[model samples]
Target: MNSIPWSISPSTRGWRYAIAVSTVVLVGLFLAQGADLVSEDNEMLLYLGTLVFAALYLGRGPTRAATVTSLFILNVGHIHPGFRIGFHKFQYVISFGIFLVLSEQIARLADNVRREAWQSEELYLFTQECARLTSPQKVLELLCQHARRYCGLELFASLAQIKGAPLQTPRGIYGWVTPAVQGNLLLDSLQAQTALALERIVQSERSRQASVLEATQKLQSTLINSISHDLQTPISSIRGSVDTLKTCELPDQDRQVLLDLASDQIARLQKLVQNILNLSKIEAGGLILCLRWISVEEMVAGVVEGFPAPARARIRWQVAEEIPEVQADFSLLSQLLSNLLDNALKFSQGPVAVEVSAGLNSVRLSVSDQGFGVAPTEREKIFERFYRGQTPRHVPGTGLGLNICLGIAELHHATLRVEALEPGSRFVLEMPRKQEVTHV
Candidate 1:
């Protein structure tokens, strides 16, 4: 109640009093014109209309003013003695007193209603504002601002890590709000609500942190397990070959074969590491393309020749006679082709067809292999990092190949997609032709 000032603005009070006086005077004159039909004793009864109006809108002061002015006007203008309170006017006095008491009670009730309405509106707006805020600090700041504006109280609200009660007032201050009686209750309720909201936000943040920690732990376990299994075979092969070379007097051809085997294993290790690094860079948003116009035929031929003899023998091509050059990063395009061809050869014994065709604005290079095509549900999932399918259990892979290829294609502004053929899976790379074609 202390937070709510009892007085209205002088200008507003003056306006309400003016309206009350004008209404009373007009109604009194109207009654005077009908004097013949009404008795002098009943004239005060008409003023009740003006008094009720004043009570509802004009508050106690203006309503009392209206009541006093109406009684004076009745005693002076309509009484038999005319402006004198004689013996016959005692009944009029009694009526005036009853009207005054009734008006005061009605005004008091209206004032209570008005104050409750104002408080309800302020609390509702505060709740809406709090709902829009995400941070606890912001909610506290808004709470303090509303306290100062609505309650006329300067509050100091802060989140503390103390034990004991939820709200503390160790300073022995009356309350956080002014006029310590009702204000204390209001402040207590508000503080408890704010504390509960803050606690809920804190609990939510803790849950989110726990979820992130659990995900990180799971990823760490998965990477360690996957890399360990993938890397162990090649590493053990290389170690065994090196040990044999060091301990045994093997034939020259056998030693050469072991050396080649070690070299191949080392190359495989390097490729695996490169794929992992590429994926990390892509995830970190650091993959940048060094694009240049390049001959599609030569790039595909070079990539095909880099494969092992048996793998190279499985590749066949039908490139267009005069395919236009595409703007792309050379090393990334090579890796993309390498991953596709490796995937095809790993899964099927049938020859892999490397087809390059020219369109009006783009060139398409597709590698199709006659293997069990990707499952309908697993088509898109296969392109996710470290995702492996159920088929080809005997094949060795880190499952980063297709994902890395997809990232490189995106960096080069190309599109990569997979389609299920009748007896094969076709992996297509469509690069926009940004340069003119030249006959070789």
Candidate 2:
């Protein structure tokens, strides 16, 4: 709607043509006074009608010109004594001239109002777009387009580390352009204000993101330091006791019990240290998968065979006999499978079930538990570290197992999904048939 072309001239070509035609009409009316078109007693009324036409079409200056010319032609051309140039006639012209100036001033004032309203509307839309934007160059492009809506403009953007300094563009990236090539300098001033505002906003937002990343990194470091320090004492004690037990003489039953307790404690301590260490590795982005071309059949068999004796009755496997070779780190794969199976055995009420499918050069493994199925709303939440489910507190488990398994699977380029079945819940691991090099 604002595309009304508010340019150097508010008067249109149509208005110019109308004014010319109106002037000719006024002149003709005077020349036609001999045809009884011009009146004697109604002279005031005739001039008043012409004055209204002047206000309607030609505005102030033209209105006053029309008045004076009409008066002169009425006396000279009409030869009417009443239309003569007298003191009263001059007074009427002066009054009519004032009215024309007042009308002109009103038109100019209204035009200013419309222009300001249009600028406000454009500014509002530009602000909304700016609110959702972050990247400096993208914002600059938008700024140029915003100006283009009002009129065409050029744009350039730059990023600086500090206030008012030139930016260091890596890989030949430039940040700034001049508006001179495509648009008015007025638009440049508008863009400069926009850039300055965006600069402030971008600075504030960048500072916020930087602060969050810094805090997270700091927390991770603190946890790693604390965990490392905490493990030293128990680890040393466990190693010392293990060595002493090798040489000490004791009864067979007592030695057996001591050995069992020692082994269990050692396993518990090892699990805690390892969980934190794996988390630390992931946080630092130092995780590497030592992929080796290995058979999925062997991987499945190894995981089943490695299960604890206490859960032997709960174990079930339907691994594919002709599983294809998959590239994976054996140790990490073993750990992931171990964690998934361990979780199933711990939470499941009836016997746990394992199903392995091989197809189209890919493999998928699913572990199902007959215990309570996870609620739909909590499914995603269960994958986060240290998240305990709705299970009773007495259950002997740490929440880190599933989270670690997910992290390890991701590192190996595999996908993990949890689905709720009618009688149980299932954990599925999927790996692509072919691998490709990663790109940044």
Candidate 3:
């Protein structure tokens, strides 16, 4: 009902009026050319063509223009008495004018539809962001606002991950809640799923935090219990044996054996301490390798030389003759090799074999044992900190050997994988072929 300002405002009535006027003009011309066949007194009937056109397209002004032109021509041609703008003409003119007015009103309806569509797009994007955005509270508020705009009705706004559930808003509960409390109505079949999904994201984060904390606490407890027992008995025996040797004059050969046993125990304790420190460094994300080009010969020889004779006798070799040098930290690389050999020997019933191979862009060193092999499913998860092979149950280990080996491998930008063998598991360390960077 509001007045439409005189502009090219969008109106279907305007479109209809323009169409109507064109129809009338074309029809009126046909009637004029066929004047002989048409009635002189009923000449105004020719303008009906213009009326129909005006009714469909043109507004009142244009329709009136067509009417005036039709009237003027009729008067000048002596086809009728001087101009007669009669009551009937006034009625037709007014009817067309009213039609123009109604078109403007219909335009407002069109505008409302356009506005609704625009708002819908905005709300859709907002809803999507609400689903994907970080911070569950912000997502909750966004969903609630969008739901209000979408259905023009809202019941509740909230996010549920572990604990807190905000309630009593406009949009009804879309199943994020436990549904125990009132106000979050469980509506049938709707698409506010993202809100519920947001809660799940929070739950996942909480679950991860809980698991990490538990693993850390477990590692700490295991280390304490293990260190106390592993170090205590060996140290006490070594001290008692040394004290006895100091008092009693024994044969040189017997004294050397006792000394060797004590030394081995001391070395074992030192290795455990070193492993603990290395594991701590890795957990803190501080593991770094002082990388250098070390020949494969050097790496293998170094690891073998450090091994006690009994262990070394059990190891066999299948290394390639022309083994290329690898970029690695010498100490860490040796430890990585040593850990693999130790794991192999510990698990193997008999001989352990080491093999080195090369591919297009990488080199692989594998240590295989004939012990009880690993299952395929456990291979990927074995690298996680303190994850032991076959769960060590009664065996004495901190379970940090493989994890420390992993950290060392990672520092060298290498990958470690466990391959299941028929008799045992083969551990492979693969690294990209290090290319020399020459200065320009």
Candidate 4:
């Protein structure tokens, strides 16, 4: 059932058949000369074997030539009254006819087996390729390519109905081909494989959409819960302070204390609201950068001065000498550093150190705090929105600070990361020394 081992041109095939037949005939003649060796019947069998070889290896034209040559040589050289075409008896004529019939039948059977094997091989390869493709359009394109290569047919898809026997699947009619290719078995098999590949692609897309939907729902729920808890606490504190001032008479000093407490709670509420608004603007792709050249020392000083005197006294900062200026959105960069400093002050009792240093191609700003350092496993998770690690419940935070800082760093094409220190943790932001600012 295997095909001919190799393909040959028509001229080359003729030469091979001639050489093979000549060899067989010469060997037959030698044996025939020895009267005791090959009888006339045995000589006929030798030529018959030559016909079988031609059919299996040399193809239809060669096989037919071999059959006719065998018949002619047997009649003239091996039959009675040798070296003449006349038959000695009617039985000899019938024997020659039967030999011709058997040779033709063998050739026909071999051709059928070879054709079926070839079809099976083509189908197997086509199915294997389709199984690996995830795009339905790609599968369809491959189907057209295969049709053109193997069947000499030009195939194309159309949404409208067309005449002739189009290749139709359950989805709809795929395309039509020339009359010669309408019922080709290989084409039909390719169409079926394409249909299955398209179905698989659709199923995969549906599964991906379902996964994204589930994740979005979970994110929405977490945001709502975090916002509600963070909002209620500051509002309640501000309300209680006001009610006490209005309802009870108090010394001026005590009233002033209550007023400061109310102001502090109001500031906390404003910060929380601002963080939420910034996060919304970032996620909605509305945060625009106003880039300008600014000195690192001045930027650090400005952010430190914005904090309360008590908090600022606990902060120690240094700028490496000769550090060049960087182009960045001043306010956004200031907000990023402020968040890091605030977190440091809230958690650490000892002084927080801010160091600004420059590298060959980048500028590095790091804030280190002497507080409970972030655990190795929780370092990355700490940057996720609304994610708070094992901080005690009494610490008031919305967990949006680090996430917003990350967003700001990304907008300016910078890298932000955390390093655990011996007594606390260090948050580092590295920015390219020179950058082209483009609207995000």
Candidate 5:
């Protein structure tokens, strides 16, 4: 609800009072001269009605002024003698006294009613505004604004003790109202509301904090468990393969098989450790990009060559004839594509397709596999750190690859998204054809 405009200037109020009094006086004179419908007593009653109107709508000063003006106009113009202040009858004096007393009593009642109505409206507005706000600081700011606008008071909230009369709640002194006047019921109500709002905001913030702390603790627990399992599996495999080779006399082929098994486990361990390091660097804002213009064919060739010969046999690559070179960090971009290919190979069977296509202003690299496609609901979640989806086969992963890819894509000012194909999932990375590198 909007507030009443009671903050009129003294000059404006004086003009309004003059206009009201003049209109009443002119009507009274017109009745006395033009129409002999009302006697002198009735005319006085008419003036009394004007006084009451002033008391109700124009406030105390106007009411008192109108009372005095009504008495003078009645005595001079409408009394027994024409246009003269001669009190020929004692009854006139008593009538005048009665009118004055009535005006004062009515004015006092009207003023009290007006004040109470204004205070009620202010309280309603304050409560409504406070209800919509969630921050204690915002509520405090609202309190200060309300006090200044409605009460002509300057209010301030402080953490330390205020020297002057302070508006205090049960919790503590949140602020003070300045330029002390006599204690007012409206101001006291505002103080109480402010305190209650602050308490509510503080309690809400505490609950939110508690919920976040609980979530963080849960995430930390999950990370610890996943890391432990990932670390132990590789270490156990390498240890077992080494012990078997050391203990038993084996055929040349068997020895080579064990050696290859140990090597695979070691490679897996290295990848995990490297992923952990990359994640930390990304999170810490320490991963600096060494940007350069690199051809799409070269980048794809480099990433494909990193895989073992057998894994490479299952990979296929295609690059557009008129493809443009993109500005990116070669090492980071290679890592991103390698992670995507590795993820595709682990989840799918048959062949993995690595395709590079050029758009009007960007280049897109998509790694698609003939494996079980990602769930529609899990596509976005798969990019969150430590998030693993339900898969048909037990794919060995720490769930950090896609997240790392996302980080690298962001660093290159690119976008990475997964599309669910009919019997496969395609992960697409799009990078701008040209980039402005402010710092290398």
Candidate 6:
């Protein structure tokens, strides 16, 4: 809007000319009233004053009218042989021409100054508005709208004309120019501001995407590292045991031992596979709860009984008689308890303790292992997928156990946390009390 021409239009010329004529007549009357104080030789000063005032305030067209009116007033009203300029003196003629040239130059200079100042103000406002906007499409649309509305210029924009390595954004690439005022500084500055804003938006999106990609890569690497040893070791053991039984005529006792070892390894493989599948199901958002109200004591006892005989011997339980039954998915709760027990056996040296208690609003189940406790810094890390703690390097695990436990707990709307005990670590699961389940 700032580029609007300062030139007087035909419609405005009539009023401006009238103002010029009125000012001239008024100045002449004032000079005549003070005629006794003013000399004929200094009469041109009054005429020159009117011209300068009009040029400064009313623009070039009005200034020209004032100059013409001055000449008529100077020759007819004040000069001798008033009605004709032919009788004017040589010095007076030279003075009149000089005044005409100087006044027109002043008007032209003033008009140029006005135009430059308006353009500067417009550029300032354009940049301020562009700075506030972050979206490219809105900037392009505003640019076009402002150009037409303010400057009366049509802005032509295209991606091809934009100079630089362009950004591919949801808003797409946009470049704009005021075709009629192609090399205008105001247009150039506006376009530059827009390009800078677009660059910032693109860089922000790229940075966000890079962070997500880095996290995904780290997760994939962790999963592969965890499963590689757990899967390979069990498969190799089972394969070697079977190969021995096939090749040699073994005694019955020896064959039985080999078969038992193979069966144990198979079981280990099956457990690892199940953990992997459960973790996948949780991550893929496919977990569904078949919630049931089951006796807390029975669930705890069953999980302990299902463990290997040696592990079962080391597990001690303290179940509160008043502990309330919990609402949970039966199978998922079983896996969750089994994982907690397995983790305690794998990490602890002394007997592990399973404690169940009830609060006013919730039931709490905790497994405490008497071993080297988790490091303070690694407390939260232990629950993350495939994250092995620093202390138990020799323990056989894929680091997926606790993560599976966490998922199962969440599905039942429960909380699982690890507390570093004085001499070991304690894992606690709390299930909130809810209304009786609607059977499905």
Candidate scoring better on TM-score of 2 and 3: 2
lDDT of 3 at 381: 74
Q: Of the candidates shown, which would achieve the greatest lDDT relative to the real structure?
A: 5
Residue-by-residue lDDT tens digits, candidate 3, 49-163: 5544443344454555555555555544424434453434565456545544554444445445544454455545655565567676666555555445443446354443333
List the candidates' TM-scores in order.
Answer: 0.74, 0.65, 0.60, 0.77, 0.85, 0.61
The C-alpha RMSD in Å for every predicted model, in order, reads: 6.5, 7.6, 10.5, 4.8, 3.4, 7.5
Give per-residue CA lDDT, model 6, range 147-249, as digits (tens).
6666556776544565432323356654544353556665655666666666666677789899989999988888888788778888899999999999999
**How far out, in Å, is residue 27 in model 3?**
14
Pairs with backbone N, CA or C atoms under 3 Å apart (clashes), candidate 2: 156-177, 157-175, 158-175
Which of the two, 4 or 5, has more TM-score? Answer: 5
Winning model by TM-score: 5
Off by over 4 Å in 6: 1-190, 207-215, 243-260, 435-440
Q: Total clashing residue pairs per candidate?
A: 0, 3, 22, 0, 0, 2
lDDT of 5 by residue, 1-440 (tens): 46654422344587657855885787666766754788766777788788778778777777888888888877777774467777888998999999999999998898789878878887988998998998777877887787777667887765345655565667766555454556768777887898777777777888999999998898778777777888898899999999999999999999999898788778777777878888889878888888899998999998898777779999999998999888988888998998999899998877999999999999999999989889989989999988887854356777888999999988888999999888998999998977765321
- lDDT, candidate 1, 404-437, per-residue tens: 9988877766799999998989999997877322
User: Higher-lDDT candidate among 1 and 5?
Assistant: 5
CA shift of 245, model 2, Å: 2.9
Order by TM-score, highest first: 5, 4, 1, 2, 6, 3
Clashing pairs in 5: none
